[model samples]
Target: MSEGRPRLNTEMVRLGGLIKQAEQALITAKTIALKQFDLTVPQYAALFVLGTTPEASAAQLARACLVTPQTMATVITNLEAKGLVDRSTSPMHRRLRETRLTDTAIPVLEGADRAAVQIEEALAVEFSPEELRSLQELLNRTITALHQLG
Candidate 1:
């Protein structure tokens, strides 16, 4: 159609742009969320994953955070240097370093969580409950379809 030129008005193309733009905005808000703790958004994400998974490898954490292993390594190194997290050889996989949060990180993560919630609440104030539910359902279906495609 139209000499094979790309069209931005297509449903999928518009949906992809919306998702990307939302993610970028969320990342910015999360960065502000963790700024008080002197942590970057990725660092906060890694810490949260480590806190939950306890002794997770950087690669696994990277996959969970949707970042490259190389980028995750740098985030892990930074967390380790700050004494917010520690890494040791995994019992089952000796080569992989298992990482977890330190005692100090819990409080910081809690504060960051609150900040993130505030941002989320502010964003959600404009949407009705039904709209939010519908939006989430559509997003889940889209994600499932993309996963199947991949």
Candidate 2:
């Protein structure tokens, strides 16, 4: 439609297709790993976030996961039911409850980490080290841009 520039439909279409493929690949990997633990994707996400940032509150976890507080509350409740996380009142703020990994959760999180590493290895097998680094850099930039837009 531009006066002189050629339309980039092919490039746009290829990028869209690659994005869709990558999204499905991620979902498939997570789904397979989650089946063993009887955990939903969001539940695993909460566990991983709590593992990385111990003693994070539901609101804080919500912000980390980009979910609403109510949704994160449900995630927290489910994780609690599984005995994977312990909720405690923050010493600094009695009203604010923080979540920490339980003894049982440590092993579960370790297993999840292994499963994720396997997934990454499988994906990395298709690319050279330099290409993998480039891919990661590009993904980081894209994530930053998308978060800024949001």
Candidate 3:
């Protein structure tokens, strides 16, 4: 389509296709480790976010997890039901619920984290460190570029 650039089918060679397939693969593999603890991806996500930001409210965690507040409500409910997270009325804001991980949840989350690391390690086995670093740098640039476009 361009005057002098190499032409290719956009649909067949776009970033979205690659990104989506990679996500699906990772999710399928991750779901198994999480299932062993009776958790879903969103539930595990809630625990990880709460552990890092204990003061965050459900709304805040929802935004961080890239889900709507309504969907996150379900995630919080499941995590609470499993005793993995403790939700308290926010002292600073009566309408908000501040959430955090329970002591018993740490080991489960750690196991899930280990499982994720193993998946990433296995996926990276074919790549050299330099190649991986270059890919990361390029992906970072692409993300920044897309954000600027938006």
Candidate 4:
């Protein structure tokens, strides 16, 4: 351990492990829920971003979705093939392509959103509103602390 740094304890280690496990569980549940819409988690992430940021570049989508540019490119190609997205030359940057969700994707996203929301609601129901608020604050602080280390 570095000078002035606190030593790790079992509770700290367990907290990290629990966070990872919770994340994996959420992903697995989302994977199963998204299957009916023929969407992968990454695909859903991209669409969810595009829903609010229409005509966004793949690079922008990649950053917003926490994916690499190469991965976003592939996802865009697949979505295009499925008629879920359309790409066009950016008016301001002719060399760049902008992506947007198609009409076909609207209904698919609606259903997927409902399924995802149901999972969130189920989780929220397990905690009191005050507890949920505190958890959210703690998670936000944790994220900020982690980012400060980088």
In candidate 4, list every pair of residues with a backbone clash: none
Total clashing residue pairs per candidate?
0, 0, 0, 0
lDDT of 3 by residue, 9-79 (tens): 65677787787898899888878867777878888788888878886788998999989999999998888
For candidate 4, the TM-score is 0.89
> Can you tell me which runs of candidate 4 are displaced by over 4 Å?
1-12
TM of each candidate vs. truth: 0.88, 0.80, 0.86, 0.89
Evaluated at residue 92, the lDDT of candidate 4 is 97
Sorted by lDDT (best first), the order is 4, 1, 2, 3
Give residue 131's error in model 2 in angstroms.
Answer: 1.7
Instruction: Give the Å shift of residue 147 in candidate 3.
Output: 1.3
Quantify all predictions' global Cα lDDT against the true fold: 0.87, 0.86, 0.84, 0.92
**Candidate 2, backbone clash total:** 0
Q: Candidate 1 has what TM-score?
A: 0.88
Give lDDT tens digits, candidate 1, residues 1-150: 697887665455577778899989988987887799899988988887876898898889999988999999999999889889988998897788889899988998888778878988998887899998988899899999999999
Show model 3 residue runs off by greater than 4 Å.
1-12
Give the number of the best model, judged by TM-score: 4
Give per-residue CA lDDT, model 4, range 1-150, as digits (tens): 689988867555676677899989998988998999999989999999999999999999999989999999999999999999999999998999999999999999889888888878888898999999999999999889989988
What is the alpha-carbon lDDT for the whole of candidate 3? 0.84
Task: Please estimate how well model 2 matches the true structure, expressed as its whole-model Cα lDDT.
Answer: 0.86
